[model samples]
Target: GKVIEGTLSVHAKGFGFVLVKKGTDIFIPLEHMLNAMDGDYVSVEIVKKVPKKNPEGRIVKILTLQNKEIIGVFKSSKEGGSVIPSDERYNNPIIIPKDSLSSPKIGRKPKNGEFVVIMRTGWNENDHTVTGKIIDILGKPESKEMDLLLVARNNDLTIPFPTQVNKALTGLPEFDLQKELKSREDFRSVPCFTIDPESAKDFDDAISLVQLDNGRFELGVHIADVSHYVREGSAIDKEAYERGTSVYFVNNVIPMLPERLSNDLCSLKPNTDRLAFSVIMEIDSRGIVQKYRIRETVIRSAVRFTYEEVEAIIKGKKHSHAKTIHLMQMLSLILRRSREEMGSIDFDISEAAISLDEQGVPYSIRPRERIESNRLVEEFMLVANRIVASHIAKKSTKRNPKPFVYRVHEKPDKESIQSFLDLLERLGLKYQLDKEVKSDDYRKILDIIENLDYKYFIEKVALRSMTKAYYSTKNEGHFGLAFDAYTHFTSPIRRYPDLVVHRLLKYYASKEKDKKGAMKGEAATLSKKLDSICTHCSEREIRATQAEREFIKIKSMEFLSSKVGETYGGIISGMASFGMFVELSHYVIEGLVHVSELKDDHYDFDKEEFTLTGRKTGKVYRMGDSVTIKIKSVSKEEKRADFLLV
Candidate 1:
């Protein structure tokens, strides 16, 4: 009935869809796209309406261009040069003028088959091409440098801090130890320590534990005070908001802030005094929070312990903080039990750790182990987040809650849950679904299958049935954590939402004298802005996750490239009419076994049972069935591997 505004998501085939904030996507055919490229904000008028299928639309106007630069492979010919975009959404190649290549600004001409970053100058609709100039050369394809650059450019991740941002950082006040101690709660004498990976350089969180005289424990979760350094609306703050979150690739990181801030000023380095937004909770021996306080504080970390070291300490190995470590272990277990009793679902999925050589090529791939030390830190962070969120939620009524960002995990849809139950029934597993199935029901099913051979497959299916968590201005509660209120309040150095939480908390705290008056005007402004911020942060988080997964996949394929013809045992992780995916044992890599590779007999796919059965021979290949397979081939560019049944 009227022109609607939304972000245009262009497909590789020239067609696209306009994703509205509160409605279903409007499908725009190729001809009706009105020259709108991928990631363009556009207004569209509905041309056709359908009940079940997507509504058709025609682009009315281009509001803005979201993607201004592209990373692609440069192909030069005698006729001219063009760049084939690495991002599939931008199907058309960008035409580059020969003279522009040799320009003084460009420095040198890009060679054929080289990867390059191109800044869009203009678009030629009639010619169906985009015009751009070579901004940077990103080495050869499949190389580590090129792969990382491609991921960064495709995700719109800014690699370098702007001059203005750097200048703003330089103008920031140096850490005045005396002034900070006077202004903030002095926790410098506390026995605080950081636990992180051995390779980590930026430590954003620290923990401290003390036995209280009242027979309770004082558990402190201190987060790096990033918001203190990054002033709101400043160049640095604006840049950080746009980035939304730091992206961690397998071998590199694209930080939201400058290295000066993230790695030095805001890092909780051992033996150094640092500012922190701390959550101090007085929790009983039973893991119940009796009281808590959120405060700006100064802390000096007594030591830095890696997860490996903590694990050893927990295993009774002698260490300097052995007593504190034992107490932490005890508290974490109590808290974990408390959560489990409340129906928190723990999806204990292992991730792949790809070891790279000096050249950035993967030398090995192994499943990363999750130990008790990891859980000890995680449980504390979760509790700290919950404590802060509950404080905010309680301070403001449900009808008029404060403007805050929450990490929300919604309940699974009924249809997905039913499908999961059906699958379980077919697999001969016992699971009685109630009218309203809580997370505890799922946990029960998981516990039953914990020792089964098909446990991983079942867990994957259950996970797929669940919805993804995202940042939202509305507190819908975190179903996964079994918390009625929760928000990310830690790791400001890496996560932007955590930084935003710190800023909002500080803003609210500053208006304690006129809380009601401040909530009426300033809170309204914040509420309006939070919607967009939450949406942007959620989208960026998804993009970062995708990029990380793609990086891992690329490296996994590379690791298998040299192992062609090698045999390994694998479980059938997935099945389709065309092929089946097999996940190798002891490795996190999955390879496809095409249906055509089953040469012995004609196969029939049973979708209901998720199996491929041989018609004459009566042999079947089912999900979770272990089989021997030989690596057939590897495609590094496609991030794929082929396997043949042995």
Candidate 2:
């Protein structure tokens, strides 16, 4: 028995590789890798394979298996029932024996078009199949919220908190009701307000800005003090740790905390006495931070403004609260200066938002925007995060200062960056990015993209070349934010990290004796756990994103199901030897344009550029290139949609 330790990297074909120590990845064949799925840790034996081409292995020893379960589409066969798993990486299906059926006869099932969650019972090595029992029947995947539910289940996301966790939230300390807010700073008199989307419930941040006598401006970044409600080691805290942040899907949101906290108690609702962790900064006309203060305060937001109202103010049109239009102008200037001095990359990407009618059918997809209010709140939050991170970093020494979690974004892979640079060159853009390219250097690339004739193409390429940011114990600095020290401290109502930051800050803010040391030790423990939490949260976030995308895809397919033979403008999203994926421009719906459907001529895949090139006519369909496509076939059962190049 050989012990191999590594992360499980899944392949598109359902099989996966246990990426062992260093770059050594051992292939876990579909048959032998039992009780092991994607993201699982397992020990494997070198079952006869040469090292040169690829190392293959068999699972002869089982050290530990991840308790993570998967949600997928279930199927039944003539020879009994089994699940044809939906995850592309998990190639093999779990076969449910005739006797394993819960109630209905093994062969008799839901009209051949339902979805189910399969519980992995065991695996049969000889037959090379996974054994499972049908645990649930997630009726028609085409339903309104079924796609979201399936995606969540598939991504290992628990849509509802466990019974125990929910019950534990009852009878919480009446800290909010107790009028012990005498000592805290009262900002209720000030005209502080919240600005968020119309549908937003978790209002984490509020803003209050006023000009001082000396011409300097006082700005407040007030965040919901969720730490005041969820104590350390509490069930809610543990659950929040498990779910690092709330996952917002197309139609619903899987909240990090319960609705009582996220939407009611901890939310910065207008005209309500809400506890908040605030960052008050005094700045001159030039956006220079003159003085800053971090304090736990009580706030009652005067009003709530939507992004539309703020946009109206920015456009110089008279809207509600026209008196504070000057503040909006000042914030605009501050954002401009921050972008200029910080070299923030200007990346404008469109997001698809679904609108459904009474029948639950998607009526439209409107592009979402980040209006002036969004930017104003963003700048203030960034300032607060930067200040808090800097304070923590400065207070902590090189050897052992204070332990704190910092959001870090490492440099993108050199190869991937070079590839993107090469694409930019091919697109006839002039921008130099080499080994010395820092965070600020991204601005040059952004500038080139902005100036390019094909701005969208260049922007897409640039985006593909960037690395994602995540929270961590070690500080590598955030490359995207152009910050030396950055932490998320302005969304305690929604993000667990923000709650942690609030707890640490309030602990240090306490004037009472003997409380400071215990807070420091607790903060250290949190700091140490940051890395593990970072990885878990990052993985969960990705899973949630993928699930959302899949749900959208399903909805798109459902929409196209009734429109077969209808043509629409589309962009090539993906390509393979068999077919190319085209996303409709109007609805952002994706479907496969099969190779055989190219009636004009036979096409061959250009591997170098990832395009399908017609051999005879020289027509090419490449990623991001626009073309017209007609829906050919759609099957909600198979979860597939096909299109033909028109």
Candidate 3:
């Protein structure tokens, strides 16, 4: 029998009813419910269906448990302690085991107010409650930062790498690193340079270009050869694979590889010999790649240029190195042409990079934008990666295709795109929504919004209407980059997928041409496993993105904490019955302006028009409307920013 699927509705009393599929709701008796709580997906067995009565069903099994890890404030009665979960959906206070509780490490235990991470152990249906054990005390609930706790709890992240994994990394034998460099091609004579952000520690990729005798350019994309340092099946390799990607929190970075490899040996520091997997691309002035080669190379970087420095060079700043400046100019022009020809979506999204002082207090909130130097590195990497992917895909020796992990981006959902189209139509923007939206279409939209005085709100809405790119075994190509095949062959130090691709590329290079056909079976098996890893990596990417957003939100609130009652010009980003979200002009920090504070007339939200309209007055608060707002309050503990209508 097919078990009915529905959400469970529990009450403050000791019982709840399961709303079964389209039929009458079933009564899950308090005792018969076992450990099932509200909002749990339970596989229920239909016990009885009587006439004119609600169906009675017994829980056969628990399909899924909501809220795997709970974050809450700890409170202790004389008998024991319990956690009041942060989410109101699970209002039940979970009892904490006494043995699992310990006194606080830093100070006298927060007897009745410390925050902690609790894992649900069991639930008592008779009491309509959940029982959990305090795994670890996070911090004081009133601490300046509560966002990290929320991030860890929401993602069920565990601190401290496994002991065995740590021991493996510590006990690994040091390879003959110096001797291994002898076999690689030496690029010490070339004027290789690294372009990165000023705050960056992990330098992964470097570029060097020279005009060839045949009027073509030889562009070298040298990546940090992480595979050369971290041996296969080693502890470091296993740990890197498990992490999949680095986690970037507000003030810190939990890297994929250990510091010894990622920040030291694998880092392509200037004026030092470093191992690299090099891609030599022969491209014409017309931005066409004529031929390319991949090789094991050793390079000494001559210079390290920040994005700011590169941007200066592009703007014809009188730099000492004339040749490098000219190359930068040529590269930018080439990239612009390539981007347009490929219909690549050139978007301008501001990333909030907070500046912090020594004691971890927020100093300032800065918005970083992509400059010409950023595009210089981006274009070279794209050319390098495309050459690698195309080269690998073109080989026809094997029965089954060679397995390489690719960064794939699927097309956006039609319904979501249509919604954005409808929004544009309402805005009176002449965008062709009925036709397929390509990179060119995106470029045109960006241009349209850029020229308009109210471009900020339009771009914000446009951003909300797209899909995120992720890793996959099957290359659907990258829609954003407009590449038929794309793979992450650079930045192996930070990204795990790139490391995997580097290892695969090296393995292919090591094999004899005659034996390539025989390697298909093993490659196929790895491809299947790589696919699973891609999904896991993609999910982790989402988690990382959310964590980054949460950190930014916290920093944004802190930045405005000092400016309470200060009024600033803001644009409405979102609107709801409760309040409207207003993004400040200078800082771009969005805070809620509660509806209760809005005087003059009662405003009702119109869902169809996506606006809050005053019934009595004709004033409207639409998505892109600008308004004056005063910072009312900033709550670091609550992770919220509140504003008042001026």
Candidate 4:
């Protein structure tokens, strides 16, 4: 028997899978598990290996528990109390004795049916019972606030700012704004403005444009100087690093930094002199950068325009900066075309914009419209990220090198790419890839399928084929944006990596001016520090993204609860061994249509084509297939919906 160790992911049903480093996951039946829960790291011994089937393994050891603390709804009984896990994937309840509640951390006994968190304690394997101590009592699950709180707790997101961080903020010393202004470059004279979402408060970036005498355009991208206020290794910085990135849950946001810094001091509020790291570039009409300057500067934005307002301006509306915005639009188009020509893969994906009322009830959920204004801001940020990455890369030659964090997107694997191409060819669209798949090849395939009814399906498949972009000390380049170098340098208010990038730039700037000595060996130390930070921050980023998506899914489930049994037009968005996922046409929501619901005929799953063929009726259900489905059930607790094909 061979033993392998990996994290265990338990299904809602009792069985689980051990996700190893490579290949198919090892299947662990319920009886074989040693009461190991979901997210637990465990060692398994391979018992059987059959061809064309996943290797079967029995859990030999429970190395460590993934979730030390669990979130659940408390139930008080005469004997004691038991907390039912909120995720439901855990499928186990923790019992808490009445004595454990005498001096609970929350200072009171949790009411029956109240949401709470508990620390794991000893357990009995014979009775399949586990014990825990109540630590915190979250609100009742029926409460309006519980919608978001439940999602946050389930995702392991700690929302409240630590008291130590707040105390450190109060003890922060003040600096003279005027004195600091004299020491940095001044960009206050530029006619700059911030364009963000209508509800945005933390304006971290601003845009300014000027026409140069050499028949070139001067584009200025200014970002908030968050690192200037939150000193490194301070309590505030430590807390921000722990949070890593902000979690935007509909209207509620869990900011990485406290509001005092993210919303006030570090925010680039309009009509105020704020410290900034600005990148000014001189470019020709075709969007080729002739020259660029990166500096620390003081800027005063004249106004803050929302994307909607700018969209109106683009459509011939009148504003003081209407002409400037129009100019920005022209420049964005050129830059977009230039980048695409250089093989940038622009997956024209639309993001869902869920609108909720004051009570956290969703009134509408639809894809956000792509407009010229959105493209304008995107082009500027992409250019700035690329230019900053290029600047840092050049400073590090072979002999005299510097350590920096780069956002790298590696080339897609050939197997995944072949699957994507096969799907396109099956749909009657023919496209070819070079010896090595070029970014533009995917872009060209997208263009061919642009007007197809199943374009979204094809686009998603292609996107999945590509590797996820991440931070690294080594430069693998950005395949999506077609950039030789790229980094996140635009939003320091919400992202920790951006703040670190700002610090690195400032350090280089100071070193260049002072020509200083005795900062030797700092590069080596900083390199190690940055490499570890990149891995931690990347993990935190994925957590934040999952929490955000889960919140939306939870809310969507709530919205569909009353519509049970109602029929809606849907598209088959995904396929799995158990069921097919259906995307409801009316709303930005998807639900599962389990195979058991297909009672009309015995169905055979076509693994290669990702389709379910009805043996008697000759009906095939597949990705992008349109069908009418009735909502069967909605489990708000589990954040899942069940659909039946009508």
Candidate 5:
């Protein structure tokens, strides 16, 4: 193959791999790296090929450098200043020129040990060190604001809305109630209400329940009509598309759209009439949708209830909207059962909710409690998304279907499934998993291990076995939700795909017979363009997810930094050749237990069993094993913690 081009993914161990589009990654030895850093686009030639082993390659050319901006702590020396990168993968410190302080446009001078953003200018081949100039000085190290800035910069998240985007917002006209209502169905009389987090600023969706006289239920799912204000090809829309989705950090939110829209115009505030794209469904007691209609509508939310409030109502502790809450609870249960019957797997992993003090410092990390209120909103949103997707799929013919974005999840690879089964066997779990397993097979294993101590560990493994879900122009269906066709039809304010779906729905709804046929050519053109859009959106979404996780990790480390030497109960979440990862029971943070810390005996790692076995003592530290560990050290720069077994 003529020198294939791919993105280089670097490891902390000096070597890296070039991930090509259509095949296995090509491993590049350290000597053949050709100065290419992580996330760089490079052209590589396969130099060594073995039948079973990974193909080794040499980077022939670096097409583009991905990490042009570096965020790190500044260290001033008598000779000159340098930056120690937060990401340890870049081993060499970036040499900062003394002239950086004289440049007023580069912002305030960075003090020693303070976080700074460096614009990589060049590299010194002789010393193997990168050179850069300090562009912005972030706050002091270990500060919450500095942590947020580092995470944002490292993930390439755009923090500020561009001036042009903000200007575009000014020209956008306010929702003319009388004019807009003329074109949209009026659902103002519907007893609709929004359920969201207590601290949520943007309420993108609302739910309403009405009991029909004929013993059926009408469910109204109203999503804010963001497309009305953010027109396609506008500055705001382009920025939103580039962002792909809103990123929610522990203490801050980087919204995809400006506050002028996301928080005000697009937010479905209670007692305020708002424009929305509504999905109204009529279903029987069994959660089977008898009929449904999707249309542009105007709705007035009667009330706004937090998840806690709704949960309280469900539990009969509150009387406000008790009837509606009961009806929603009933429908949600039916929907859950129906979905479970269809082999939908529910991996209810606990997510950490880091509690922050007034100064934005993390004080505690606890598992976020999930209640019926959360499930109610989720089940309704799932049904709405599925309904919208089915509508598009039904209207679309293979020859001339409207171009649409789908959330696709392909079946897991056979190798991954076998590996998971092997893990189950090693764990001594008596569960049967076939080579060619279906969704139900995994569900059965999960059910059997529901009450086991290793349930979460097994759940993580099962999740790892499946393919990651992504956006696509073609409908491959969603494996996790067990849906034949699915699109993001809700949360347009936060997600770009949902906004695109809304636009497509409007375009198709307005097309006449002749125009519809003429639009076939446009659809074909759109289908081709959607491939790039899907890929970009998927990549951006991953970046957002990583930033979110990094923020949480940073906060967790900060929270544990003050408690070094204290012992805590934990479970081994992962294993490696060097050490095993232990996640504390009370806190969601995970730390490394290096094999050297097993002072009683020398330990050897068993790859297949995922255990650290002591040669002399015959003691094993395996995945899901409970142990007590004393915090040895915490590195905010490395964003990790080290633990010593007690």
Candidate 6:
């Protein structure tokens, strides 16, 4: 058996995969997992290799343990029963000792089928049992609010500030508007405004654009100065660091900061003297940044416009800021053109906007409408973040680069890119593959498929083949954005990395005047803390994204459950040996139509072409092929759907 080390990704069905660096991920069956938890670093031993399928592996050792909160259903007996985990990824049942039968929250024995949380004390290798005690009993989810509570507990997200955080909040001052305005650059008179979603409450960033006398444009991107209020090492800052970023659900949000600061104090509210860290850039007519300055400023936002309102304004509704909006749109177009020319890969995919009723039942699902107004704001923020990152990276050497958190996306691996190219060739679309893949290669293919009927199918594959973006202290350069350096600096109210970057920028700016202070081992002290911070923030970000995606899938399944047996138009979005996934028209909901359900004849799967064809009937199913389907079954708990081919 050949041994290899990689992170384990467990599926809900108990099977798992270990993704090594060089090839397709190795598979591990349910019995071979060795009780390894999802997301655990493990050593896997390859036991069998099957052509056209991933190699099968057995877990040889658990390299690292994940201290995760446990939630499960309790089954009690005299000798200490067991708990069945709500998450199906846990292959083994957890044992609850007789003394652990009594719940701490209720101070009573947990009845069968009651949802309870457990704290794992240790694993009993002698008995091969995972031992734990019941910590809290979450009563059965009888209502939508209780369901929300269950979701929050599973994800470790909570509302209202902690006691220590609130205590630190009291120490913050009620800034004197007069005194604050005198200490920094004043942008109160500028026509600055915020554009965000209609449901947005915490306005973090605002923009001010002016046509300079020398014919260059002055663009001011002002972000909320959260660091000014929440000092480093404070309780509030520590809590924010733990959160990493805000988690937005279908009906609620777990904010990174308390509402007092997120929505009121640090928010760039209109007609208020708000503290801001501004990035002022001077750009020529061709969208080239001529010069820039970073400064702490006091800004009074003039208007807060929603994306819909801005779109309406752009379509000729009369308003005082209409001219500014139009100019910003013109500049955004130029910026986008320049970015595309620089080989920045833009994946133009439509995000699903799911709407729920009062009872948290999803009733409507559609693509989020993207307009010129959205792009205008996005372009400004991207430029500001890029400039902030480039300023530090360009000035320092590779060995002594400033210690900062960067939003980096590394280049795609050759194996994944080769698979994608093979798929393209199978579909009869050919292109020359360079020795090394660049962002521009992806950009060119996406442009070619922009108007093709199979655009969605191909684009999804290309995106899946790319590397995930994460936070890192090293500036490896962002492959997707085609930038020499990049960092997030636009939304400190929602993101912790942005706040840390703001503080670093200010600290370095001050030290520029004091050579001795700048040489005071500041880099060494900061560098020691950065790697862990970046890793934690990246992990939190992935967790938040997973939670958000889970909620959407659950809601989507619930919606589909209502339509069981109802026929709808669908397209084959994905294919596997056993089944094909069909996505409904005008909806992002996908359901698996198993090969067994193909009634006419026995089907054979083409692994390379991803085609399922009948032996006798000659019926073929492939990616991007249209077909009618009916919902056969759906499981909201498992977040899965099955469909019948019609």
Candidate 2, residues 5-102, lDDT tens digits: the string is 77666776557688887757888777776646776666677766675855787765444445555556666677567776666666567777766655
* Model 1 per-residue lDDT tens digits across residues 33-117: 7666778888999999988999999987767766577788899967569888776566667788776565566678888898888
Q: Residues 502-561, candidate 6: write the lDDT tens digits.
A: 998988887775654334376877877888888999999988998788777777887888
From the highest TM-score down, the ranking of the candidates is: 4, 5, 1, 6, 3, 2
Per-candidate local distance difference test: 0.87, 0.74, 0.77, 0.87, 0.87, 0.86
Clashing residue pairs in candidate 2 (N, C-alpha, C atoms within 3 angstroms) = 14-89, 14-90, 14-91
- Count clashing residue pairs per candidate: 0, 3, 0, 0, 0, 0
Q: Which residues of candidate 1, in runs, are more than 4 Å off?
A: 1-70, 81-104, 118-135, 142-144, 398-400, 513-518
Pairs that clash in candidate 5: none
Model 1 has how many clashing residue pairs? 0
- In angstroms, how far off is 188's CA in candidate 4? 1.4
Which is the better candidate, 3 or 4, if ranked by TM-score?
Answer: 4
Assess every candidate by TM-score. 0.88, 0.85, 0.85, 0.93, 0.91, 0.87
TM-score of 2: 0.85
lDDT of 2: 0.74
Superposition error at 346 for model 2 (Å) = 2.3
Please give the range of 10 consecutive residues that has the lowest summed lDDT in model 2: 511-520
RMSD in Å for model 2: 4.7
- Residue range 175-260, candidate 5, lDDT tens digits: 89999878899999988999999899999999999999999999999999999999999999899999999999875899999998
By TM-score, who's the top model here? 4
